[model samples]
Target: MVFDERLVMAFILENAIKYGGKARSKSVLGKILSVKPEYRNAIKDLIEYIKSKIEYVNSLSQDELLKLYEEYKDYVKTPTKAEKKSPLPPLPNAEIGKVVTRFAPNPDFVLHLGSLRPLIISYEYAKIYEGRFIVRFEDTDPRTKKPKLEYYKLILDDIRWLGIEPDEVYYQSDRLELYYNVARELIGRGYAYVCLCPSEEFSKLSKSGVACPHRGQSPSENMELFDKMLSGEFKEGEAVLRIKTDLSHPNPSVRDWPALRIIDTKRYPHPRVGVKYRVWPLYNFSCAIDDYYMGVTHVFRGVEHKVNEEKQRYIYKYLDWKEPTYIHHGRLAIPGGILSKSKILKGIREGLYKSVDDPKLATVPALRRRGFRPEALKNIILRVGISPSNAVIDFSLLASENRKIVDRLANRYFGVRNPFKVYFKRVSHIDLIKIRKHPDYPERGVRRFEFRDEYISLYIDFEDYSNIISRDPFRLIGIGNFILEEADKQVKIRYIDNDVKKAKKEGYKFIHWVPVDHSIKCIFIYPDTTYEGYSELNILDEKVDSVIQFERIGYFRIEDLGRNNINVVFAHD
Candidate 1:
C-alpha cells in the first residue's frame, strides 16, 4: 500500500511530542496498518520508513516540533463529541430567577462524601437558575453536637474548594433572639407549650398517646414558663418547649416533639456564644425558622431526613408560611471508606488517624490531601443527581474518573521505590540526556541530566531489577539499551547502542530510572502504606498540591516539601 507521508509524519510527530519528543516505531507502524491493512504484507519495510520519520521528529527542537504539529495535526484524527448533554437533570418547579437552594450543615464535623451530594446538587441548581444559594450552619445543639470554632471556617473552605460560593451565610447561634420571639409567638398562639415533665413520665405518656398534665396549661401560663426557662430558671432537661403535634401521631417521636430546650451554659458552653445564652433551639425549630427567614425556595437533603421534613412542616403550618420545595436524595455510601463522624472521631482519639484530614478517611479535606481533584468529585455528584435510591460509590470509580483528568495535565518524571543502584560501565565521555517534561505537551519544555563520568550510576526499582536480570538487553526508558553484566549487591550493566529501531526489533522491555546523583528524596504515601523513594530533581520545581505522574509509578500530589525530602500522596495509577 502507498501511504501518505504527511499523514504518517503527523502521527509520528504527535506521538513523539506526547511522549517526551520520542515516538515509538511500532506505534506508528500499527497506526498505518490499522488504517490500511494492505500495508500488513509490507510491515517490515513500513517500519523502517516509520523509524526514519521518528528519528527526524525526535531531532527537532520544541518550537520546530510545535510548528510542524500545527501543519499536520489535522491529519491526526481529532476527538469528536458523542453528544452534548447536561450532567444533572433540570429541577422540578425551578423557575429561572425565583429559585433558591440551601445546604445546611451542622458544623459538628467536617463534611464527608455523603454530605457532598446535597451540597453540590443545591449549589449547582442555584447556579442553573441564577438564584441564591445559602449556607446555613445549623449549630444550635451545643451540648450534644457542639459546633467547634474551627470547623465553621473549615466547612466554608471545603465548599469554596468545591467551587461554590454561598450567596448568604448564617449561623443559628447568632440569632437566638429571633428563635426566642418565634417560640413565644408559637406559645401565645397555643401551637406550642412549655413542658416541665420529667423525661421518664413524658416518654410513657407520649408513647401511650396520652397528654401529660403540663400539656393542658393555658397559653398565658405556658408563655410565662417559657420566659422563665429562657431566663435560666429551668435547668437542662427540666424544661423543654414542645411543638404541639397530634397526640395520636403514628410516629411517636413526632408527637409534641421538643422544639427548644434549656441547657446549662455553665457546663457545656457553646464555642460561639459561650455562656451568654441558657436556651437553645433543636434541629427542627432552628432549621424551620432560618429556611423561612433566608428565603430558601428549595431544600436538598438526604432521604434519611424524610421524617425530619415531615416534622419541620408543622412549624410552617403553624406560622402560616409557604413551604419550600423539598428534594431528598438517596444516601451515598463509599463501601470501604469511613464516612461516619463518630467512628472517625473515635479513631482520632485512639491515635489511629492523625486528624480529620487523615489520608485514610473520606472527608473532603482528606480527599483533597490525597490528590483527588475537586472537578472529579463534582462530576461524580452531578452524575448521581437527585436519585432517591440508595447509592454506593466504589472508590475505584472515583480513581478512574480522576485518572482521566490528571493524565494530560500531570507532567511525567521517574521515581524509584525499593531502589537498587545499577552502574553503567565502559562510558568513555560525558553525555547529556534531554527528556520531554510531558510527551503530549512539548511547550512545557524538557528535563535535562548531565552524566559527567565514565561510570554512570542510576537507581532502578528493585522489583524491576529482579524481573529483567535474566534478559540480555533491556531499554532504560529515554536513555538507551543496556546489557546486565553483574547481578549482586553492587549491580552493573554495559551500555549498548542508542538505536530506537534496533531496541524495538529486538523486543527490549523499557524501564524507568533516576540518576543517583541528580534526584531528590521522596516519601510516597498511600492510603495503607508508605514508601521512601527517589524522584527526578526537577520535581522541586513543582509547587505543593500540584499533581504529577511518576512515569512507571502512578500519579501523586505534592503534600509537603521538607528540608531534605518531598512528601507526596498517591492519587491513582
Candidate 2:
C-alpha cells in the first residue's frame, strides 16, 4: 500500500501545530488508521516513517506551518460558511410589542448551560417582538432547596454578562401575602379546600379515584381553616390548601395537587424575608399566580415542565384568569457538565470544587472563568433557536464557537510547556530580536526581547528535542538554523545559516523558544487541571480577562495578573 507523502506530511504537521509544535507519533499514526483502517498491519512501519519525517517537519517556520495546517484542515473538515441570522420563531398568540417573557430561576445556584437555554431564548424572543423581559427569582421553597442570598446578584451578573437586562426583577419571597390572597380566593370560590388527611391515606384515595372527606367542606368553612392555618393555628404538614381537581383525571399527578402548605419558617426562614410567614406556596401555585399577575404573555421552558403547566392551568381556569402561552421545548442535554445544584453544593463542601467558577462545573461563572465568551454562548443558543427536538450539544462545539470569536482579537506570543533547555554554541551574537505580536496583524506591533549579554539562550519544548536529532538542520524559531554537534542531556549546536528561507528550502521546522532569563512565570489552567509553565515576559502586561494566544500553544485568557506571575485559562487552539 502507498500513501501520498505530501498529504501524510500535511496531516502530521497540522496535528503537530495543534499540539504546541510537538506532534506525537501516536496521534499521527491514529490519523492514518482512521483514514486507512486496512493499514492495521503497517502501523509499526507507518509510525517509524512518521517519526523519521517529524524532524524535517518540526523545523518549518511557525507561520509556514500554520498556513499549511489551515489549508489542509480546510480540505479535511470543509466547515460550513454561513451563519443563521433569522429572528426566533414567533411566540404563539403574542402581539407585537406586547409579548412578555420571564426567566424565573430558583436562585439556589448559578445558572447552568441548561438554564441558559430558556434564559437566552425567552430574552431573545422578547427582544425580537420588542416585548418586555422579566427576571424573577422563584425562591419560594425555603426548606429543601434553600436560596443563597449571594446568588441573587451573581445571577443578575450572569444575565447582564449575556447582554440582557431584565425589565423587572421580582422575588417570590416578597409575594407571600399575594399568594395567600390568591389561595383565599380559590377557597372562597369553592375551587380549593384545606386537606388534613394523612399523606398515606391521601395517596391511597387519589390513586383509587375517591374524593377526600374534606372535599365536601363549604367554601366558608374552608376559608376559615385556611385563615387558621395561616394564623399559626396549624403546625407544619398538619394541613395544606389543595386546589380541587377531578379525582378521576387520567393523569394521577394532576389529581388534587397541593397548592399552599404550612412550613415552619422558624426552622427554615426565607433568605430575604425571614420567619414572618409560616404558610408557603408550592411551585405550581406561586408560579401560576405570578405569571398571571405579572402579565407574562409567554412561558418558555423545557418540556419537563409541561406537567407543571397542566397543573397551573387548573388554577388559571378556576380564577377566570388566562394562562400564559406555554412553549415547551425539548430538553437540552450538555454532556460532561455538573448541572445539578445539589451535586455542586456537595462538591463544594467536600472541597472537590473551589467555587462556582471552578472550570469543571458548567456554571455561568465557571464558563466565564474558563474564557467562554458571552457572544459565543449566545450565538450557540441562538443557533439552536427554540427547536422542539431534544438537542444534545458537546462541550467541544462551544469551544469551537469560542475559537472563532477569539481568533481575530487574541494577540500571539510563544509559550513553552515542559521546557527543555537548548544551548546554541557558535551562534551569532545579537543585542535584541523583535517578534510579531500577531502574525496576521503586523499593525498590532511587536514584542521586543533584548539580550543584555552577548550569547543567545532559549528553552525549547522537551518533546521537540527529537526534531534536533532526526532533522540534520533545524531553525531555532526567531533565532537562526544550526547543525547538531553533540546531542545528549543538553543539545550542543553550531550555527550553520542565519537565513530562514535557506533552512526552509532544506525542509527545516522552526520550534518556538523563549530566552532563559527573559521569560516570566505562567500558570496555564485547563478545563480539568493546571499546568505551570513559562511564557513571553510581555504577557504580564495583559490585563486580567484579556484573551491572547500563546503562539504555538493555543488561545488562553488572562484570568489573573500579578507583577511576578500571571494565571491564564486555556480557551482553545
Candidate 3:
C-alpha cells in the first residue's frame, strides 16, 4: 500500500483518542496495533525526510531552486544519508572528549505533561554522564517571555520543586552579541546571503524552495544589506539574512535558511537588550551560535530536532566551530494522553480547565495533587535509559507504576460518600468511637478519626450494594468484620472482624466509608453526587496530585478552609 502521511497520522490520532482511557473497545485496538505496529516509526521517518528535503531546497539561490526541481522531487522520497564520520573541526585534537548536557526549560509556564519524559531522561543522562546541567532561557522573544514578576515566578519554583534544577543558569538575551558576530562571520565567508523576505512569504519558501529577488546578490552587496538589517534598516521581516548553502543537498534547513531578522516584534520589550537591538537570530542560528559560544560539548534535544542536528552542522562548518556530539531523544507522546501543550493551553484559556495545573489536566501539578510523587515520574521515564529508540510511552505504564509506588507508602484512610446513617441499634446510644487512623502503621503519624454510633458513614460501592442485601457484618477494614446492612438508603452493624472475613471468603461485596460519628467533622465533597449504588464513580479525578488522601474512601484535598470548619473533604476525581 502507498504511504499517505496525513492519512496515517489522522488514523493513528483518531484511534489514540478513541481507544484512549478505556474509552473504546480493546478488541478493535488489538486489531489496529496488529495492523500498524510500526506507525510511529513511519511518521518519524517522514518528518526527518521532509526536514532534509527543505534544507536541500533552501541551500540554493532562487534560480538554483529552479534548476533543482527534479532533485527536490527525488529528495522527498527519502533523505537518509549515511552517518558521516566528520570530526568536529573546532576540536580536532581532542578525542574521547568529555561533554556536558542540559534541559533548558524557561520556567515561564508549568510543564505540560508532554514535556515530562524529555525533562526526566535528560536529567537522567546528565546524571549518568556526570556532566554539568544547565538551565538556559531562549528568552530573546520578549513578546512571549515572562517577566520575573510575582505572578510569573511559579514556573521556576515549580521546576525546583520537581527536583530538576540545573547546575547553571543562562539566558540567550545575555549572549546576543555572540550570535551577531557569528552571523557577521557567515556573511563575510559567503556562507550567508541577505534577503528581504517577508515572514508571511517565507513560510511558503520554507518548503517551496522558491527564493526571492535578492538570492543572486553578491557577497559584497549581501554584506551591506545584512549590516543594514542589523541597524534596523528595514521593518521586521521586511529583510532577513539567509544562510548560503546547497539547496539541492537533500536537507531543507541547510538551504539558505534565515539566521537573522529585524527584532521589532509585538511582544514585551526585551528584558536586557531592549529595542536597541533591531535584529534577532532565528532559532537555528541562535542555537548554533550559542552551542558553540558557550563551549557546549554535547547537544541533546528532542528527536523532533534530528533535522536541526544535521543542518546545524552547517553553522559549525561556516563558523569553524566543532560540531557538538549529537543526541536526539523522541518527544514524549503518551498513549491515551492529551499530548499537546497547545491543547492544554487552549483548555486553560477556554475554561475547560482551571489553569495549566488544573487537577483535571495531566500537568505536573495535577499529578502532584493526585498523590503521585515526582519520583514516580522520574522512575517511569528513566526506565529504559537513553537511546535513539525513543518511543512515545503508554500512559497506562506510568499510571500503573505510580499506583504501585503510592499504594505502598501512602497512608490509608476510610471515607464514605452519598452517605446515609447506618443505625447501630442501642449501641448507637454511645455517641463516640475512635477509629485508629492508619490500621497498618500506627506510629507513622498520630491522627484518630472520631465516629459516632448514630452517624457512621461508609461508601458501599454501588456495585457492592447491587451485590448484597440486609444484615451484613460491619467491615472494619483491616480490623475485621463486614457491615451487615442493606445497600438501601443506609445500613449499620457492629464493627466485627470475623464475620467480615467470612463474607470475603463467600465473595460478599464490602464497601468503603468514613465513620461519620467522628468529631473531627470531615466534609464529604461532591456532596451532591448520585447515590444509585456506586454507578457514577469518578476515578480519573483521584489519579492526579500527590498530597491528598481519603483513607479508604479515596484521595482528596482541602480546597478552601470553611469558616469555623477545620476539616474539608474534596474528591480527587
Candidate 4:
C-alpha cells in the first residue's frame, strides 16, 4: 500500500501547533500506524518519508502550521492521552502564589541571544506559578564589569520587547550598604575576614590549600581592617574581603573566595554613582544576599556558574539562610554569531561593529532589527528548555519559524532585480491589471496598475528572464501567458490567452513582473551584498519596518523609506 505523505505532514503540523512548534517523530509515527495498521508492515520504508515530511512541517511558523492544518486536519488522528503533555516541565518545589524568580543581568553590555535562556526560563517559571518575576541588575563590580548607564534602559527595553515585564527591579549598586552590612555580620561571626594580602600572593595560598596570613586574624582585627578598607585606606587590589570556606576543598577557587574588593573609584568612577563608595561586593557575595532578601526562590543560571553556586552556598550555610533552588542549564551558542560580550565590545571599539545592534551580531537588539520576531526567539528558548547539554541555534530553523509568521501577514509585491525590459505585442491599448494583496486572504484587497500602450512593457528580474528565455511560452504572474518572440537589445513577446489553469497543467514556470512606467525604486540589503531592483509602485505605501513578500522572491523588511528609493532587508525565503 502506498503511504499518504500528506497524512504524515498533517499529523506533524497538528503536533507542532499543539506543542509549541515542534513535532515528535515517535508520536507522529504512532499516530500514523494507529490509523493505518497496514502501513506498520512497511514501516522501514515509510520512516524516512515520514521523517522528511515531519522536518518540513516542523519548520513552518505557527501561522503556517494553522493554515496547513486546515488543509490536512481531516487526515490527522485524535491525539491519545499519552501524547498530550505540557511543553515545559513544572518548577521543582514551586508553590503557586508564593514562588518568586529573578533574572539577574549585569549591565556591562546589552542583552544578547545567550541571555535569553535564563531570562525566558525565569520569566516562564514565574508565569507558570503565578508568582512575581524580578529583574536585578548585578552591577556591583563597577570597576571590572562596569555597568553603562545607557545599557540599563536598553536591557529593560529588550526584556519588555520579549514580553517580560518584571514585577520589581533592583540594582545591586544601590544595595551596597545592605551587602556591606551582611559582610560585617559575616566577619563578626568569623565566617569572613578582611584580607590585605595581594591577589597574586592570595592565589598561591588558595591554590596550595594553605590559609592566608589574614585568615588567622581575630574578628575584631578583621573588622578594623574592613573599616579602614571602606574608608579609602586600601587601594585597588590591596585589600579584599574573603569568605571563610574549606581551604582544603577540591576546587581551589572556592577555597576562601573573595566576597568584596576595594576599587580605586576615583580613577575608574562608576557611571551610576561616581566615587561614592570605595568598596564593592563580588558576584557571589551580592547575588547570595540579594536572592535571600529579595525573595528569589529559584535561580536560573548557566551551568558554567556551578562553581559560583558552590561558593555562594557557603554564604547561605554560614548565615543559616535557606538557599534558593538552582537550575543550571547548558550555555546557548550561535554558530556564526558573536555572543561574547567582551569580544563584541572590542569589535565595536575597533569599528568592526557599528554598535551593539549591528546586524552581524546576535545581540537581542540586532536580531530585533533584523526582523526576527521576539515570539520566534521565545519559542526557540522554550523548546531547548533546561537541558544540561548545550544547544546550537540553527539559522534555518529560525528563518522557517519567522517565515511561518510573516507569510500570512506580509503583502505580496513584485520586485525585479537587475531588471530587463520586455515588450508584449497583441495587447489591449489600455487595461488595468489587478493582483491580490495577499494570495491567502483576498479580502485584504488588490493592487492595480493601468497599462496605457498597445504594447505592454514590463520589467522582470534578469535572473528570472534568463531562466525562461529559451521556453517558447511562460506565464506572467497576475497576467496572461506570453510567448517569447524576440531576444535582441530589447526583448519582445506576444500575449496569449489568460488561462492560469492551462499554465499550471502544463507545469509552465511563472515569473513576477512590475510595470515599467509605474514601479518604485528598491534596494534589497543583505548581510554581504545588495540587490538593486524595482518593485511595484504600491510598495511605496508600506511603512518602514513593515515586512512584505516580494512574489517569486523571499520576504523582506522595509528598513528605510527614502524619497528616491525603498531599502529593505532580506529576511528569508
Which candidate wins on lDDT? Answer: 1
On TM-score, who's better, 3 or 4?
4
lDDT, candidates in the order shown? 0.86, 0.82, 0.54, 0.84
Q: Which stretches in model 3 have alpha-carbon errors above 4 Å?
A: 1-97, 106-109, 142-152, 198-223, 266-276, 426-436, 445-503, 517-573
Per-model TM values vs. the true structure: 0.84, 0.82, 0.69, 0.83
Tell me the tens digit of each residue's lDDT in model 3 across 1-573: 123333233333333334432222334333333333433345556445434433443454545544444333321221112112211011111122244665655445566565665566555445544556666666655554443333235555656767877777777777878887877777777788888766667656756677656777877898788778776668775888877666565665567777777766444456566666767777788887777766666665676786776677788887678887665445566654565666777877887766655555566666655455676677766553333455666656766776665554554454444444444443432343334434566675534443444444544444444434455443544334545544345565555444655777776555554443332333444322322222112121222232345554554444433333323233333
Candidate 1, which ten residues in sequence have the lowest lDDT sum?
78-87
Would you list the rank order by TM-score, best first?
1, 4, 2, 3
Query: 494 in model 1: Cα distance from truth in Å?
Result: 1.5
- Residue 313 of model 1, lDDT score: 88
Give the per-residue lDDT of model 1 (tens digit) for 1-573. Answer: 345587689889988888888888878787665544445556777888888888889999989999989988766663222111345654545566778999989899999999999999998888877799999998888889989989999999999998899999988999999999999999989999988899899999999999978888999999999989977787888999999999899998999999989888899999999999999999889999999988888898876787898899899999999988777677899977999999999999999999998888999999999888899999999887776667889989999988888888898889997888999864654388889989989999998888887788999999888877895689998788888888777888888878788989988878899998998898999888889988889888788999999988899999987768899998888
Model 2 stretches astray by more than 4 angstroms:
1-87, 426-429, 502-506
lDDT (10s digit) by residue, model 2, range 366-465 = 9888788999999888777665557887888998999989888888888887787767643345556788887889998888888766555677887777
Look at candidate 3 and tell me the lDDT of residue 369: 50
Using TM-score as the measure, the top candidate is 1
Clashing pairs in 4: none
* Candidates in descending lDDT order: 1, 4, 2, 3
In candidate 1, the residue pairs with backbone N, CA or C atoms under 3 Å apart (3 or more residues apart, or in different chains) clash, namely: 17-439, 18-439, 18-440, 19-439, 20-439
| Candidate 2 weakest lDDT stretch, 10 residues | 75-84
